[model samples]
Target: MYYNTNILKSTDGESICYYRWQANPDVPFKGIVQIAHGLGEHAGRYNHIAHLLQEEGYSVYANDHRAHGKTAEIKRLFGYYDGKEYFDDCIADMYALTNLMRAENPNSKFILFGHSMGSLLSRKYVIKYGKELDALILSGTASFIKVLGTIGLVTASTVKTFKGRERGNAFLKDFFFGEFNKKFKPNRTKLDWISTDEAQVDLFEKDPYRTEDFSLGVFLDIIKNSKKVNSPEAFKATPKELPILMFSGDKDPVGEMGKGVTRVAKQYEKYGISDFTFKLYKGGRHEMLNEINAEAVEQEIISWLNQRI
Candidate 1:
């Protein structure tokens, strides 16, 4: 399956560069998979996953979120949200893309796949627009720690007050990701915590788009939204009927070594989302999709989707 790169106008008139992988023309269309990538990465990183889904008769679409990937390149606003409504704006842009996909395949099931920070955005999305999706897949997701989130938000805000929102705060960046690589003692690189696969980490380090330092404002936005998604009210607002699959590595620091991921699962159960599934890969790190056992992880995802659709 091949993909086409196109631009879509977001709700606020931001130009969102997206990729669309149409399912095999000869095969019956199965469904639609909209991918939301993690922070500091582009939608293009998931092209292989899109190909797999397209081959399985599912059309795939992924957009470069604001201040990331091609969209950031086009706007020249790398790592800058440019406004206070950063998180909401990203969700709106996602909804815009969702509407486009639904318009093209009105009868097909729609699945939203989000990884890491994207997973947080997707969680927020379900609260407002859960009915718009047939299912949800969250990768490298976690339940937010309220106390730490509050401190991070305050710290980021203070930094932005002293410096500028557009200036990248190396201290804030370290504060967020510094501890992630600690588990992997004598780490080969700073991003070894992302995946056990050294090659993937190398590729990430080499990719210019992935190397962009996030601004303090971006950190603040992420912390604020992370808290929102983890709130009990947000859980109650989620559509209980929507099927959700949450998967992560046991060693993923973002998931707090799997404890946070488990907490999220329990929250879903408490909120009456009976059709929720949680999977933890032993010894796996943050980015299971790029890990050594990535093929197995991909197969597991496909198997789950097949059962659902």
Candidate 2:
């Protein structure tokens, strides 16, 4: 069964909206999995995945991050102000929800599954609270911000210098679609999964909960946090024995740069962190969970969790 509710996080004064899929509530659960979605998307998009997990005898919970989906915030589609605040709020909110879930199911193990930007935040949370989780899965992850930070810094400075000036969405278009400019026209509608699914693309464009733009300040904040997470200090903070699963698509742009998912694993290996597994999907894209053969991906995830947890 599916249930939706909101929990007021006293820690940050933000009401976190979430969904819970109860699978075999009577029988003791093997574990609980919390999902964190990528940018421009909301937790509701994972309804199908939640159902699948439920069928697999696992309770699933997902929350829409602040400034995204039904969460309260300014600048509708774009997040303004401190990006670290966003990350902090997300961690606090996740912790709060985990506590609540644990209270209800005391015997179940806890695991976290994060995608894209969410994967970045998951790593930060793990470094701080690694002992609390049994396992972690990072999908479509990379070690760097991919120039979004540089563009955000410039735009943030411009906004600060010229108060009351509004910048166009040209930066977003350029940063996300600049490479495909010659091959295909830059239409905001085609920004789903970097694939050819017109129907899915249309759904994404029409989704009211989806955010397409972010404030210069918020973008810069994310850049700063991203850098911190990739730093040697943060890498060292993570326990060497914590089991981590990292996966990404070979064709995804995150894998295009020298800072691909494998690069992330290699960095950790350099620090003697060997309790991890990294996989690359041959032709998958950024949103592997939403791809054509999502079952294959889901099965892979379940198999990993079964072995580790």
Candidate 3:
């Protein structure tokens, strides 16, 4: 599989860049897999996953959000996006790109896969654009408690008054994710929460596009959107028939040892979602796709997609 990079002009005047990977033309494609990557990472990181999906006759697409990855590196939109509705712009970007690609490949279904922060955004995406997709897959995701979200609002609002949005701040990252590496006390790298695979962690560390920090505004937007997704109202508008797979690591701190991930899945059920399932990978961490047993994780997801799509 080959990754073809392209830039599309967004409705909001910003240019969005994406990677499109098509399956072998000799075989009929099953559908389109459009991925929304997590924060501090780029779309290019999913190339390996794209190739795997392509082998199964699925054309995969992953886009860099406004201020991350190749889009940010080339356009210089790192650490911050252009507007206050940072989260809104991200969903809009996905909506635009998904429609464009779906138009070109109208014969097959569309499966939206989101990881980590991308997973949080996908929760919003499925609710708003549920009718547009055939299936949804969420990885490395969690349900955010309202109180924690409120704290984020207060902290970010106070921090912005003093530090502003244009500049990067390490305060939130240290405070929120600082404990991730504590479990792996003898770990060689700070991003040990990502994966036990040292090679993958090293690649992530060396990547220039993967910035280690984010702006206060960006963090607040994440917390707010996360709260929105976990709330009961988020899924009221979603189509019950939309097949969703919510999978996370049992040991992932982000998901609170699978408790919040389960709540997220249960919240969807409470709101009338009827065609979804949740799973936890034993010994898995935050980045299940990049974990030591990543191949098994990828195979399992592919199986699930085949069953639904």
Candidate 4:
């Protein structure tokens, strides 16, 4: 069964869009997985993944962060230019939803599954609220801002201070999509998981839930919050015993700065954080979960969840 609802988060005055799926409500659930999607995408995109998990006896819940999808604010998506507000809002929204789920389905364990920027938020949340979950899975993860901290800070500040509300497209090209453009002949709309499915790309292009461009303020906020995750202080604050699984594609541009998903795992390991595992798909790209071999990626996630929970 699948259900959709709006969760009102009082802290930020944001009504987060939440989706729930369960195969058997009567049968005791193994646990619940709260999925946090990456930037520019909405929680609904993971319905297929949620269906698979529901079939495996785990209920699934997902929410669109403040700025993305149905939760967009007038000024900006999450926060105008300060990214920490977005992270804080995301954590609060997750906390509220988790408590709501616990109330709805008592006595069940809980896990967190976050992708891309969502993974970053998940990590920060775990550090602050590690006791809330049984395990965590981070996909297409990175510490980009950590690696390019100074540069990102300068760029974001310059963009926001000068450009204000005027939308800018150069940043996306220069930062996120540059490598892909270099490797392949740049196609403006060929942005969906490197697939030949024209229909998929077309749907994504027309999806009202998707955000093609971000504000300069939000861009800077991503960098600032990312830097927090990269610091030694952040690692030390993280609960060492919490089981974590992180993975990314070796060919992912996010890994270009040497701070990809594997790098994130190594950082935790360096801080004596055990019970963490990292994997890299040889030919995979940023959106591994949506890639050609998505089944393999999904299977890996299921297998890991089986061991941990």
Candidate 5:
């Protein structure tokens, strides 16, 4: 399957770049998959997953959010997006791409798949836009502690005051993610928590786009939005009828080694979510889709989607 790189003008007048993998014309189209990639990564990295989905009759769309990947390169907004409501703006950008996807495939179901930071955004997205989605899949997701999030936000806010929002702050970055590497002792790389597959970790380390340090504003927005999504109100706002699937690696520090994912699932239950499921891949790290058993992980997603669609 071939993908076309396209551009969409965002609500704020920023050009959002995305890759669209069209489903097979011969087979009956099943659904549309919109992928929200993790922080510091581009939409093109998901091409392998897109190809698999395209073969399975699912058209895939993954966009580079503002200040990340191709969108950042094109706009020269490398670290931080303009404006205060960063989280809301990111969600809006995703929605814009989603609108385009739905327009092209009106008859198909819509599945939102988000990874890592994207997973956090997707959690918030379902709260506001759950009615529009047929299903939601969250990978490397966590149920962030409100108190910790508050502290992080406060620190980031303070730092943003001293250091410009667009400029990266090493202290803040280390304060949050520095411990991720510690979990993997004899750490060959700083991002060993990303995947056990050394090749994938190397690809990430070598990629200029992925290696760029995000600004303090990015951290602030993430914590702020994470707090919002995990709130009681956000839980109440989520459409109970929306089917949700949360998956993470047992060894993924982002999910607190699966504990945080379980907490999220429990929270969903507490909120009266009618349909919800979660899975933890044994010995898997943060990016299970890029893990050693990635093929199996991919199959799990395909099978789950097949059952639902």
Candidate 6:
């Protein structure tokens, strides 16, 4: 596949930045993979995966979620939201992008792949639109932690009440995400847990679009929506045959060191979702795509998708 960029207007009346890897013109596309990226990262970061998929004759697409990446850098949004239903806008962006891709390539089966925050959004996506897609893949995922989320919600509320919606707070960043790197003792950087690859970690740190201090409004939005998607009622509503694949590293705190990942799978099991697959990579970390053994992980993903498709 080859790479290119384009822009489309989202429902919020802002131009969305997106990237695509087109399948080889000489080869038939096996399917389409539309990625919903994690928080604090841009769609462009998946170029390596997209290139691999293109070689495999699969068209791949990814968009910068609102208030992040190039989308955030845009002058109109400037990495801020109105503190009202911002999470809903994030879901709607994926929905809009899906529709556009479907229209462009009607015959292709569209698969949803989400990581971290994107995985959370994908949980919400499957609840509402599971029947519309072929499969779902979640990486660096976990079931919600109500206690911590509650604390975050209170923090966001207090900050928003005092400083207003547009204000970014370092407290939320430290309180919620500060400990991720702590688990990796003598860590070179606060993000060593993301992947073992030092170069990738450095790249992520230097990336301009990688968010540092999140505003109170967006922080609360993550907690609020996470609670919504992690509900049993939400899991019960998803179609039984909607194939789901979730993988995380055993050391990933985001996945609660793999406990939360299993919980999510078991929740679906309770709901009678038959076609579910999960894995906890031994000695792995949060960002499996950028992990030291990412090639093996990618092959595993390919094998799973092949079986499902």
Best by lDDT: 1
lDDT of each: 0.88, 0.71, 0.83, 0.73, 0.85, 0.84
Q: Which portions of model 4 show Cα errors greater than 4 Å?
A: 26-28, 73-84, 145-149, 162-174, 178-183, 186-203, 257-259
Give the poorly placed runs of model 5, Cα more than 4 Å off.
145-151
Residue 6 in candidate 2, Cα distance off native in Å:
2.7
Question: Which wins on lDDT, candidate 3 or candidate 4?
Answer: 3
**Model 4: residue 246 alpha-carbon error in angstroms:** 0.8
Residue-wise C-alpha lDDT for candidate 2, range 1-309, written one tens digit per residue = 365756546466656777788876565457898888877688888888787777777888888777677663423434333444557777888788788888877978888988877888898988888888888888887676556556655765666466422333456535644542223345444563444446666777788787756544445445667778888888888878777888877667654522457778888888776678888777666667766667788888888887876
For residues 60-159, what per-residue lDDT tens digits would candidate 6 score against the true structure? 9899987788877776454576647767888888888988888888978889999999998888888888998899999998788767778888878888
> What's model 6's lDDT at 3?
79
- The clash numbers for all candidates, in the given order, read 0, 1, 0, 3, 0, 1
Q: Candidate 5 residues 1-309, lDDT tens each?
A: 379988898788878898899998888789999999987788888989889999999999999987888888886667765567777888889999988988888877999999989998898888788998999999998777555566787888887788767778787677666667788998898889899999999998898777346777788888877777877898899899988888899999888888888888888899998988888899999999999999998998899888998
Q: Tell me how candidate 6 scores on lDDT.
A: 0.84
Candidate 6's clash total is: 1
Stretches of candidate 3 off by over 4 Å are: 145-150
Where in model 6 is the C-alpha error above 4 Å?
Answer: 76-78
> Model 2 lDDT vs. the true structure?
0.71
Per-residue lDDT, model 2, residue 88, is: 77
TM-score (all chains, Cα) for each model:
0.96, 0.85, 0.94, 0.86, 0.95, 0.95
- How many backbone overlaps does candidate 5 show? 0
The C-alpha stretches of model 1 lying farther than 4 A from their native spots are 146-148
TM-score of 6: 0.95
RMSD of 6: 1.6
Query: The CA-based lDDT of model 5 is what?
Result: 0.85
lDDT at 148 for candidate 2? Answer: 56
